[model samples]
Target: MASLAAGASFAIQLFARVGATGTTLLRVGFASLLLIAFWRPWRVRWTGRQLLGVALFGLTLGGMNLTFYLSLRTIPLGVAIAIELLGPLAVAVTFSRRVHDFAWIAMAVAGIALLLPLGGFARTLDPVGLGWALAAGALWAGYIVVGQKVARGHPGPALGLGLLVGALIALPFGVAVAGANLLTPAMLGAGLALAVLSSAVPYSLEMYALRRLPPQTFGVLLSLEPVMGALSGWLFLHQRLAPIQWLAIGCVVIASCGVAAGAAGRAPEPVVGPEPP
Candidate 1:
């Protein structure tokens, strides 16, 4: 989580140099290469159904990255993340069986409402950016569901191949927009850093976590992402938040902690079968 936050900060800095699509391509592309080389995923013989699962996971993963980056173009990272979280919140609520879960979700909703530009220190944000963030959120939910299913197999092959698919989808768009700018030495260096911090490290951990955790638990736990994003934006991007927004973050954080506490002591779901040798 820390790695993802730090990577997002770096990505915002790189956006000034290469644009959103370029950054997405570089991050996903480099990450795919690194993971594939390390895991040597081709050693495992994948069944057709498993292959299809990875393809769907890759589609969601790629779409999520692309749309989230696009939102960052016009919105502050924290606000964008806060709005994007609605997807996970919805997922959590959908799977929730307890009353407290709904309460936590309501608190999260309150937090989101505080982020609205209706009044106070908040200003109107770009509708397009908000739309993109919402789209990213939907894809994020899809990624969580699909990732859990795929992670039941081998974490390495699923993540590496999924990223490769994403990189392929992003390649042409990145080329069309950034072109020669992306080839600069500085851009390459930054892109590598972004890939490591953003995609490679955190995603590996996320896949492992997804394999063990329930989807609703996984979704609610992601509330930390907004907090991390907000801090990173303030520290690195100098994007300050209003007092109300900070309170909003607090609400979500508390809600997440509550959910985590409730879920404590529960045994993780078992993996479907033995990992590929």
Candidate 2:
């Protein structure tokens, strides 16, 4: 539900409401404050290796969101999300041997194919949007892998705070792009609220779920992001959906859900012992 609500918010293009860069800055800024207040990570001291790991996670998170917003400038929210989900889908396929997982991947591929308005190849494409979305998808996969590392290393709030430190580095660029519009109360409020909803809430929820679920199970469930985004886009933006579009979304949801159900009782992959101090 948090992921679905996030898609709805993104469909409104709140960043594009002010400007993508400014919107990114505002969202990160507000989220940083909230995370700092909630987690109080200032007290925690980090070793050099942990600091490097935190920085890596932060960099991936910032890059992912930046590219995603940039993609939204040209692409539909639903389609952009659908493509972004491919990053994880790729990762899942690489790690799994199960034949059913391939079937799920095929469902996702079929859904994405429908996004192309394929009557004539030359006349019907958003090249720039596809470029941005694909770029974002690569970064999204990096973010997930880095996020898992961060989650394992520190408590959530502290890791979240450390990630914010790197996100702040992105502010100058975002401010430059969005500038004065970013300062407007309306934009600030919307961007800040969006940060809480899209980043803060979903991050917390997913972390909670991860703690209780196996990595493969979590990966399977995460595949639902695209389908949820399509539904949220339809409901919140009144984005008109044709029957075929609805069928595409249904296929994604069912395939992902099937993967999740199959993984429910399976043993988690073995956790090797930690390295010696």
Candidate 3:
């Protein structure tokens, strides 16, 4: 979690050099290069089904990163993360049959509502940023589901190949925005660090955990991300949160904890995913 937050911090720092999409491209592109070189996913021949699943995984992963970075342009990192967490929270709630699970859903909804520019809030957040955050959240949900499927195989190869696909997806947009600026020694060096901290290391770890944990449990665990995001933003970016925003973040965090606690005693569900040939 700290790695992911630090990665985001590095990303925020680079936004001035490369636009949002360019930072995303550098992060994903460099990470993909590292993973592909290390894992060499091409060693094995992939069947059509395997390729298709990984394609979906890559698409969602790329989209999620791009939009999340875009949101940081206007929204504070922590606030954006809190709003984005709705994706995994929804995924967590979706898998549960309990009547009380709806309460968690309601809490998350309230958190989002509070972030809206309504009731004459002390400060209004950018709606465009909010929209991007929401889009990131939706794609995050897709990533979690698709990731589970792809990680059931050779997790290393799946991750490497998936990220390669993701880099390709980001290539055009990144090039359009940053042009040759992305290739400078300074930006390249920073991009490498950003890739390692944000994408390569953190995403690899996430894939490891995703394979072992049930979707709901995995989603619940991600609840800590908003806290990490908030801390990173405050410490590194000097972004201060309004009292109401703090309250909103707390609401989501608590809801995440509630969901985790509710699921604690139950027998763990079998991980559901496509078996790799």
TM-score of each: 0.94, 0.87, 0.87
For candidate 1, the C-alpha RMSD (Å) to the true structure equals 1.9
Off by over 4 Å in 3: 108-124, 241-250, 267-277
Q: After superposition, how far is residue 144 of candidate 1 from its true place, in Å?
A: 0.4
Q: Which residue pairs overlap in candidate 2's backbone?
A: none
152-235 per-residue lDDT for model 1 (tens digits)? 988887899999999998999899889999899988888889999999999999988887777888888897787787787777
Candidate 2 lDDT by residue in tens digits, 125-200: 5778778778878876776666666565454664466548646866887877877887788877786787687676
Q: Report the Cα lDDT for candidate 3.
A: 0.83
In model 3, which residue pairs have backbone atoms overlapping below 3 Å? none
Q: List candidate 1 stretches off by more than 4 Å.
A: 120-123, 274-277
Poorly placed runs, candidate 2 (over 4 Å): 1-13, 121-123, 269-277
Whose lDDT is higher: candidate 2's or candidate 3's? 3
By lDDT, the better pick of 1 and 3 is 1
Instruction: At residue 80, give the lDDT of candidate 3.
Output: 84
Q: Rank the candidates by lDDT, best first.
A: 1, 3, 2
